[model samples]
Target chain A: MERLILRVTTKLLFAPIILFALYVQFHGDYGPGGGFQAGVIFAVAFILHAFCYGLDETKKAVPQKALTVAMVIGLLFYVGTGVATMLLGANLLGYDSIDPDSTHHAGQHYGILLVEWGVGMCVASTMMTIFYHFTGREPDINQEDW
Target chain B: MSAFEVELTPIVFLDLSLLTMLILVAFAMLRSRHLFAVVMLSGIYSLLSAAFFVSLDAVDVAFTEAAVGAGVSTVLMLAGMLLTARREKPKTPGRAPVALAVVFVTGAALAYATIDMPAFGDPDAPANSYVGQQYVDETPNDIAVPNIVTAVLASYRGFDTMGETMVIFTAGVAVMLLLGLGSARGGREVSDAEPEDGEAK
Candidate 1:
């Protein structure tokens, strides 16, 4: 795509989309958005890039191996947090154990934030990986034939 | 004249209009032969449903529906369509009737079930009287989060959310395994060879 307009616009919109996704990821604690939506939004920015530039370019930027690893990392992060809390002397997935020295409020807040981050990471990577697989399929037939 | 009636009136109208539009879209999508049109209509349907969610004050749900249903799902459908036929293959003779019967029966059953549900905004409803009330009332002091929904989802029900995340991860892996990874080289070279520039509208 040699079109100057699309190339420039995609470049301009790319950063802001990721930034907004991060904001939605963190601000979900107080607002209407959360990890799931934020993750999809983040993936959409990359999908837009794929639309504008090309699938191969997008894949280069976000490799399949990396996405798969990130997906596992997110799940592990969530499970690890729970296990850590358990080891700290509370029930599984208990936030109160995260800060045993004081009240549970602060622990709950931090635990929620960490858990949301894990959700966000898993969701974003999964969405992108799915998109990549779908778009990367072999073109067995001509576009016009369909 | 009552405050409750005033609040309910607009919501009733909104729900009716949104449902009407949703039905119309569904009918159009069903009748359409072109897969592209079907996908676009589905996206529109999703957006309209998201609007309905917003009206119900479930902004988190609205956001997810808009992003996942309207945005990502549409693109995925389009990509899938590229691999297959643009026009839907003709349905079998008896399939439509069976599907219609199934849909009608399911819809009827669901509507009938709604009759036993507590009225909207009923404070005494079992749903409200259970953990829902506790989550709402205690979220501020317990979690210090302004968004009770987030507190419930991430902290109160963290185990459930972790399972959901794992489910999604499994889905991604499943898709990857079913479809072998394609070429790593970007499509830029192919596009450069063609005279036509592929610019997204």
Candidate 2:
């Protein structure tokens, strides 16, 4: 009964934070918020949930291995955007040179979106990855405690 | 120039407010006893610094500050605290006094140097001439980004971003190695056990 109560309360507190993060992510272009702030807010929400519901439960939601993979994938996505621009006969990160047809305006939008998604992924996953490192069980500690 | 012609109303007030917040937060961070409180205060300090940057019209810098300084740095510091105790050790006077004195003198010297510097946001400053103008003007055509800072950072300064990414990757690797995470395969065992009787402080 106590565990159920804790779980319910944790979910209640975390829901608003998640919603705010999404708001920040989508509203970044026009306001003071951006991908990085949104990513941090998202990570903080997860970290709070982890603290309340135990690291094991948190891991079930976002596994450590999965987070590691996400981090790498995020970085690759960022770099790959640049590489794609290069392949399209543009200088490094030269979005204008990417699409020769439509004055490259569309390409710029596409490139920014891809890069922002990459940054958001990296920031969020890396934050969670660091949290996992600290909260994860330590074999040495168990031995010492026992 | 007539004294009446030089207006210093809102800008001066805003600058002073920013400076006050920065000083107060820095002092609070220094004097806080709880590690968590100190970490949170540091984040507040970073936010204040970001605001200052924005007021100075360095939007790109302000964005980076809000992101890396307030966001990533706070997370990293909190993670570090989790690996150790939350209480700060009492200060000792042995070598700390000398270190504090050195820091104070260096800070004073830097402040003195800035006293003769151009007022904030001076239009005729050298920074407004060489690269800043180019970045602001050509960003739309050169990089095709509406945000000049984004264009400057990702395209014009691509090499620096690559280096920064590598640094982050290196720090991640170092943490993993230090925590002995390289070869550990088994899942972490969840501990619901309460603190021991004597361990509770």
Candidate 3:
């Protein structure tokens, strides 16, 4: 009975968290919400699920190795955007110099989108990774500190 | 300027609420015995401060505070607590004297500074006449981003953003080194192996 109750409450908590994350992501351009907040909110839902259903299940849902890779990839994406701008004869992240057209509004949009995606991915993965570390069963591996 | 003149503005009420919430959260944080409760109250304080910043037209600061201060700091502190004690140590005589001296000096300095400062949101203040106007007027042409904060962070003040990113990266690296990547897994295994001798009681 307790397990059933936990499952139902977990579902209830998850629904609003997911909805709010999506709202934050889309409304970032016009309002207070943004990629970072959206990412954290999304991760919080999953972390709550891990608390309710146990860390093993959460690990299966989001493997730690994959999260590390996601973090690196997200940061690379952000830096790559800046590098691309430099390659196109612009100063670092100077969107206006991207194309022959003096006013590269489209380039600016694309650059911002890439950076925002990177920020979102890094934020989400790092949060989940922290949750995993805190909640997961420790392995038998010995370290210098121990 | 008539005697019967009345003014109604929601901003006045919101400012009062904001101030009240901030003070309440600050009090709760200081009074709480549980470290976790104090951290939660601090997060609430950060959110309230962000709201106040937004009301004062410092939207960029509000965004950063809401994200880094409230969200990220709370999560990191909670993670830190998992590796440490949940309750604060009992107060000591040594700490009381040092804390009181620090508070007295800081409060006096702050009071002195406030006397010379412009009123909140003063239109004629140097802050209003200086970079704020430039940001408002030239930002559209300079960065082409609709949100001035985003433009400033990503372009006008790109170096600072880069520094911030490096700081975050350093924090991640430091945590990984200090805790060691395998500590979490190891801790769990020991917990799992513990005997269930007290189950019946």
Which ten-residue region of model 3 chain A has the weakest summed lDDT?
A: A136-145
For all candidates in order, the CA lDDT equals 0.86, 0.71, 0.71
lDDT of 3 by residue, B59-105 (tens): 75787688768876787677667666678877764557788999999
DockQ of 1: 0.57
Clashing residue pairs in candidate 2, if any? none
Candidate 2 per-residue lDDT over residues A16-36, each given as its tens digit: 988887776655433455456
Measured against the true structure, the TM-scores of the candidates, in listed sequence, are: 0.86, 0.77, 0.78
Give the alpha carbon lDDT tens digit for every residue of A1-146 in model 1: 48779989999999999999999999998898888888899999999999999988987898887888889898888888899898988988898778756664778877877887888899999998888888888769775665
In candidate 1 the C-alpha lDDT for residue A104 amounts to 44
Q: Which 10-residue window of candidate 1 chain A scores lowest in summed lDDT?
A: A96-105
Candidate 2 residue A128 Cα shift, in angstroms, is 0.8
The CAPRI category of model 3 is acceptable
Candidate 1: Cα lDDT at B147:
93
